[model samples]
Target: MQSNFSYQTHDYFNFVFTDDGSVGLYNNIVGDIYHSKFGARTEAEEKFIKPLNFHKNFFKKKELNVLDICYGIGYNTKAFLNKILKLKYKGKVSIDILEYDKNLVLISPFINDSYFKTSPDISYILINLLMDEIFNNKEEVMEILYKSDNKKFIEPFYRRLIKKYEKTEYSYNPVSQNKAFLHNIYYHYISQRKKRYLKLPKIENFYVRTYFDDARASIKSLNKEYDIIFLDAFTPAKLPTLWSLDFFEELFKHSSEDCLLVTYSNSAAVRHAMIEAGYFVGKIFDNKKHPCGTIASKNKLLIENKLDEYDLGLLKTSAGVYYKDSGLKNSSQEILEEYSQRRKLLNLESSSQYIKRNKRS
Candidate 1:
């Protein structure tokens, strides 16, 4: 990970490096990766990104098996848990954290103002794991899901309480402003916050999972497609491969009859990629910053919010680059350029056509 990054809207600064080379937030007891420059308390209260935070209204609990591809230090993971916790449902909700660089995770706690700064369990784990893994060089940290045989360790010890089914009780609601209770809530939010992650939820009509890794590998799992997919990764500027049409089609191949891939970006390249990937991409609920957001699916009716109004200029503006490779092929500048040309040609064709922007806005 890069040593520095600045928030687009603010001059706020965060030094993400820790002494041990962890990629996480700091000053937290339970060890959460800072979700954004705003830190934990504020984001939690405001419900993280306001628009993205509320999508749960459209989804059912335990019914969605989410995937968090970048699982970096687990900030978003924690935020996601908080959201569902609010919903209070019981279904099979399982999230897999791909810790490609556990070192970044390990060194994260000491960074200062980390989301985990206030949690006790994270403090304990950070110490215990440091003793076990850092100084001792032991790999005792394994997936809790795999070691459910020890109910005590998995439950109260590590917070993996596996009940017979999913329910609102699975969510760890913060009961107080008490520092200690807050700590427990934070830790529970990370490990204990689940309905039934016992086994990977079967891909089906009712359940949609988040894919947190490279979209290529994620595509294979589309054997059971999704009703809703939170298509989040770093913007394509950093990882172009994730945005390509090739990966989108892989998701399309296994999609349920009505699937909606929701993402924050309204980048034109990504929009075009969805089209090439065989999805009928449409606009989302963007007021203006983004002329249109994306809701792509094989089934057009799946789109919840469609952009009926349009400013002809957006048809040609440079939205952030989209991933245009529609199949599982290697993407290149040439491929993106070719797609750009196509978009230009289409825009020219539509230039004579008049459309209305939302008059109300």
Candidate 2:
């Protein structure tokens, strides 16, 4: 696929690979949240990777399913996996992903393999090697790579492979290596290189793949029955269709009673949409003293977040629209005001001094 990245973001790290030999990170995980090339341990951990771990601890469940909306190069997916495995989630935590970009899948090996190669574990190389062997029709590839097999630690990776990897199917996949080039690349390189992990964030029990274009088109009622939904689409501005309020309402229809819908956005319109969709919405634990980001759910009295004041004020604003209107030909003050009045009529506010103070702030 061609590189559609027109601009690079300094803060967010974006990893992109074109089949035409351009492998670079555009550095925007949408807005200023993360960068691709320099995936700092702090931001990567705080915003995306670390948050998944936080959920593991915060929720304290053995098996949790996370539906990753914008499953990009899958750094977040791998990050979630690394954390879950570290936490030793024995029950099973599945992550279903929806990604439409094939560029991510195709060049993932070259770039991801390079990243994993930096780690000194021979088993890392061996498992992905064995992965290649399974995908390929090679008769003795795993045996050949495991020839010096005195290492006892790697036997688990092998056993884990049967219990999970080789047998465990992708609910959402990168792409099949059925093509000649991919197959040949696998067979040729599996043994020679140090073992690497596509394991950026991999869950043992579940991995569901979804196409980007089809994501909107394929919004089935059953799809919304997730425990947690990671709303990681590109952005509402760039990808307006994905962030529509109507979709939120549809998602709410399928939501579990205690489900938490999470995302990196703190947008007024997006928050408004969640409210319109029937979620008792608020900010998530931003790790700072103040609450940050958004989390919407069915629980009316879920923990009040840092965004309580800001969002409450917006609901009372002159520009208070439940969500950005994609149906409009143009957005103007008049349109916003119209929606604001509509919201006002719906009694969307609580009369509190905190709400007034939030407006002033």
Candidate 3:
């Protein structure tokens, strides 16, 4: 099982430090960062993993299938792994990841492990993913992760962040708390330098299969009814194809009866598409208990924060107009153009007008 992509990091492999002190990758091609600047791991834990209500759903099943779309640097999946580890879950976990760029998957293990607060078992899983998807064996993966100069990949970014923190005076806030946390982790990393050679955990029953192709094409090959679907696409405006009505319809076919499709998108267009595809949608609250994303499922009981009248009404405005890709075969530009033309033809009010009307009342 050899990969066609090379292991060498490219010139565009630039890393940016987020406000929460987690590393974020910038895609030169897309002109956007992969994770939110608020935090990479933070976004995954809060927006994706926490919203699952995992305690209610995970323990009920002996086996769980997860579909992770756009598995950028494997943050969402890694966050899930961290949570299940804390819970000491004994069930078999299978994940099918769809990522267009094989290069991103190859470099996933090189990201600083400390930022994730990964356990030894979690590190083993990251190494296993690299072994299965790119390398021939575990030794090759370990050599790159530990023995090679690749271990220094994140050092430059870490030093810059430390220096930036030294100069700034942060007030009592969440950002200050994150800065303190990173400082503690940095000190711990230095003290545990000798422990870097710890033995890897024996592989568990976790199964991961990665598809390096357009999600629209890769989704068709999936055979399992996924229990959880993490749809962390770029954005509806930048990449509408994945957020189209047809794409949601395809997801509906691949979902189990109680499957929860979670995404960091609360866009009216995206929600409208999900509702049109026959799924009941609701808001995903942040740690501060604010509506941060969307969660959709066939079972309405799974949604805790149901969309209110104002939120539902927003769908009827121009912002609620969904991107269309009939047969799931249109390009991004084509879909955006079609969506724009449709919005022009409709007599619906603008989203701004809707917001203003609600605020006055």
Which of the numbered candidates is closest to the native, going by highest lDDT?
A: 3
Q: Candidate 2, 211: how far from true, in Å?
A: 3.1
Residue 228's lDDT in candidate 1: 45
Model 1, total clashes: 31
Alpha-carbon TM-score of each model against the true structure: 0.50, 0.57, 0.81
Q: Could you tell me the TM-score of candidate 3? A: 0.81
Clashes of 2: 28
lDDT by residue for model 1 (135-163), tens: 22222233222234422312242232212
Which lDDT tens digits does candidate 2 get at residues 12-125?
Answer: 444344232223345344443323333422333355554333543334665666666665545455555445555545555555556555334322332332234333122232
The local lDDT score (0 to 100) that residue 37 gets in candidate 1 is 47
Model 3 whole-model lDDT (C-alpha atoms): 0.76
Q: Over 4 Å off in model 2, which ranges?
A: 1-24, 27-44, 49-62, 109-204, 221-224, 285-292, 300-306, 324-361
- Worst lDDT run of 10 residues, candidate 1, spans 160-169
Query: lDDT by residue for model 3 over 36-136, one digit each (tens)?
Result: 98888889999999999898877768989999999978889888888887787778888898987776665565566354344545644664555434433
lDDT at position 202, candidate 3? 36
Tell me how candidate 1 scores on lDDT. 0.43
- lDDT per model, in order? 0.43, 0.48, 0.76
